[model samples]
Target: MTQKNKMKKYGSLFMATALLTGALAGCNTDEDTSSSGGSGNSASGDVIKIGANLELSGGVASYGSSIGDGAKLAIEEINAAGGIDGKQLELITVDNKSENSEATTAAIRLAEKEQVVAMLAPATSGNALATVEIANKYKVPIVTGSGTAPNVTVNDNGSVNEFAFRTCFIDPFQGTVAANFATKDLGAKNVAIYADNASDYAKGLAASFKETVLANGGTVVAEEAYVAKDVDFKSTLTNIKGKNPDFVFIPGYYEEVGLIVKQARDLGIDVPLMGADGWDSPTLIDLAGAKALNNTYITNHYSSEDPDASIQKFVEAFKGKYKEAPNAFHALGYDSIYFIVDAIKRVDGDITGEAIQKQLAATKDLSLITGTFTVDEFHNPVKSATVLEFVDGKQQFNSKVNP
Candidate 1:
């Protein structure tokens, strides 16, 4: 072979090698590279996967359904307005069945199998608590909107769970609000407590309410406990009625609380009923009956009747979308998703579990559909609670308690 031909062949080979190397480097660039977990390209080339581990069916189905609906509204609006960094957001939902063990399994599926960047934890504090283990194990952040139990994000030793956060105020504040409203507004000097012993949320709120009732110089005449899914609260109601308390505070899910209220009223023991956000379900009115729901109040996250522009806009949007006013659970679910989207936007790239978690920790006074609040050091939102009264089977906005 000629010397010129040999040089040409070697040069051509070198150029080919350089071209291949450049192509490989290009693929590793920011636009082409994908992160691990469901947030990355494996889930969808141009969509961000967010896990919605919710109790879509079972005792708390009403709460879960409302929450999911609100989340759906927020997701649609966000996608319509150009999703985070131009990538559409996708929700990968799993039903926890309103059970703690199932919640843990759902979290595992979301974190390990689906590889979601973050999860909107179950609507209940009990379920959220169960899912926390998976969040920490997988290094993914999980935020709950309606989990009001203080320990939902705060550990028993007063430390914040790094991967856990919630949008709602803690039970201490909510319970205190209820106590004050009962004693100050209702002129109640004696109160009875009925709690869902099976639920961490109910137990936490009940304990806080008792503490506050004493602090406010009101006597807790009696206290009773009931398990979830227990339809019969007649005996408990009879015991509470016998106490002759001026009002009864039942911190439990709407499902059981509805029956409890109906039974309490049926026994001719009609005082006043107060509860936490758990009672903000439409089914509660249906189950308890409009007459039973009268003279009742609950500490809620948001009231659809709020005159605030943001609140009104959200309410209108939700009503337009679902053809029903958004409840506290719906607002909570909507706000939780925006929080996640905000964190993802702040990160700008590589939507991974670690990245989203870090950004979520740094969140500031983020305005949301529920309320405006900053995430405190303990990962609990520093927000206000709204006191709502049931009038003619509808929840009316009574007042707002700011932090």
Candidate 2:
């Protein structure tokens, strides 16, 4: 053979071998099966693994732990009843260390490593934002149980991230409702704001409340901020006292809110305290005492006393298990899991994140323990919020507001 011809033949043969090797490497094999035990098919004998990222330790551990428990309960129930698409539901959970970015990263790593089909997350807004980018990168559907910030799904590009979803109502509506109740219902003209500066939930709710109050011709006489871990609020209370406002607005979780209310009353500031859903906890009454919690108004998801069948069933089941009535956080956590399960049932298959997201977007009129929820275009829940007043150490449902 001529030299050029031999060279061309050898090159062609080498190219053909390389192509064959690449094709063989791309073929699916038993070793290539996912650790989730599935061959990427629903008919295959595989356990569907769902992941949970929450704050099992740290400052907000109490709330996060409860959320994790609620999710586990839902998974248990589903598994007992023969899980979605005749597959067993497996739950994987990790702690995000109560809003720490490093902890969130670690939890995301664990979920990704486990190859979870979907993930439920950190019970607060800050941690939710911290982990969302990672979930988006991996294309895992994450449904947060307690993150209420308006930006949870709405991005700067005016497009919703396909991987992100939430089960709670946004902060804007809760803040607006609180402000409206303060102005129209409570007839309070001058209000003072005490916000937790460290929490995105607190800050966002406070800002929304301020805007709504101003729009309703209610004047904000004073504004004070504090960190989440700070227990002493005497300084802020002293400042708010001088303003002589008709009421005080505290946008923070029950832990800090209870302390703030107790200390405010101790400091001889007797104005009624108003807050958002963060105040919905049994511990709040015990921490703040009946005297401090008296006349305090807050917005919440569902009341245990609600006559609705769904709410009643959840309350009974929760009380039977935990020996205490479930709080708004617990209800939201429970509902979030069931909501995701319903989506899974709707899109029956090898549960992919994209499939769950599409199903969630189409969710409408889902009757849940919290309330009837419909996922809006922005992925926010359109539902009703119940207004509760702590009177005589009990939460009394005053009214329900629809958004």
Candidate 3:
């Protein structure tokens, strides 16, 4: 009846399903795709399954990999410390391949076939948006780590999506921070916007940036758009260069953002670039090179350079496990899983999605590796954002902006 015995009895089916699904999706087996490591248990079938639907492969795989690492670390620690009630945590992670359709499919598979009580949505807003519909339709609660676009959890009519929740600040706050920093601190008067037209995340941040820029007595000299997965950005950069804006604002994932930075620098555009949390990934530096990323800035959820005791502890633990410093996505993912587990404990080990959702709605002042914040009515976290400046290929802490 213990957790280990329950998993030994029931985990075969879960393992088989995961293997079959991974084969079909061509997912990486070596990664921490699943965790069921509880060794001893005293109750029967005391295993709590949670779904992780993320971009584990494809353009934004870096985000998925880092987030997965963070979540895996948290789950390991939770299970080691004795899981909620008597149940051990089992994370069944699936790769959405960084596509909206794949995210929807992954969510469905987790909810129906995998039978996860709750879901951790993808790191990107576009993918998270697709999962939102599936989560609501299947009555499953889905939480996101870094899907900051406003509409990720809030519907178009300004109503909250009852089953959708996120642990990061929304696009408005992020965009406004970038704009405020550019205008007030950097003193950029005219700005050019290069946005990913194919991504809701990019479009939402771009819209907010433009609005904030205009309101702050700045002019948008030019704005160009590109679709996701587009490797060719010379034409867009050339067009933006013609306008000669003081700063270029790109609110997209690191895969494309890194390319844009390199291409822009190649085109002799020396203006500073600013971006949102989507820019937080190791792939960015790998693709763009350290020198090209110099003078760039991003609004993020956490800074690795923070000297806070809790922040330092998390950094050390993450580095010890992953052999690399954790990024904003890692912090967000770590906090998100903790948030879900905390809610589960508050409900006295109720593994039902409904009960967990109710507790998530009431989350307040929960201290996390990222920061302490409460869930607002729209299911968005009201937390502070750190503006990080990339200098010599390293992210240095800048100013902190509160929402």
TM-score of each: 0.87, 0.86, 0.87
Q: Report the alpha-carbon TM-score of model 1 versus the true structure.
A: 0.87
Rank order by TM-score, top first? 1, 3, 2
Give the higher-TM-score candidate: 2 or 3. Answer: 3
Candidate 3, residue 356: how far the Cα is off, in Å: 0.6
lDDT of 3 by residue, 1-403 (tens): 8999988877898898988998967643332132212111112277888899998998788888788889999999899999987689999999999888999999988976787878899988888999987777666789999888889888899999988999889988888999999999999999999998988778888988899999999999998999878999999799999998999999988888889999999999998999988888777999999999999999999899988899999999999998988898888889889999988888754457777888899999999988899999999988899999999889999988888
Name the regions of candidate 1 deviating beyond 4 angstroms: 1-44
Candidate 2 regions exceeding 4 Å error are: 1-44
Give the per-residue Cα lDDT of candidate 3 at 232.
91
lDDT tens per residue, model 1, 235-326: 87888888899999999988899999899999988898999998888889899999888989999998999899999988888888889888
Q: Give the TM-score of candidate 2.
A: 0.86
Task: Return the number of clashes found in candidate 3.
Answer: 6
Query: Which stretch of 10 consecutive residues in model 1 shows the poorest summed lDDT?
Result: 32-41
Candidate 2 or 3, higher lDDT? 3
Model 3 clashing residue pairs (backbone)? 1-43, 1-44, 2-41, 2-42, 2-43, 3-41
lDDT of every model, 2 decimals:
0.86, 0.82, 0.87
Query: Per-residue error at 363 for model 1, in Å?
Result: 1.4
Worst 10 residues of 2 by lDDT: 35-44
Report lDDT (Cα) of residue 332, candidate 3.
Answer: 84
Clashing pairs in 2: none
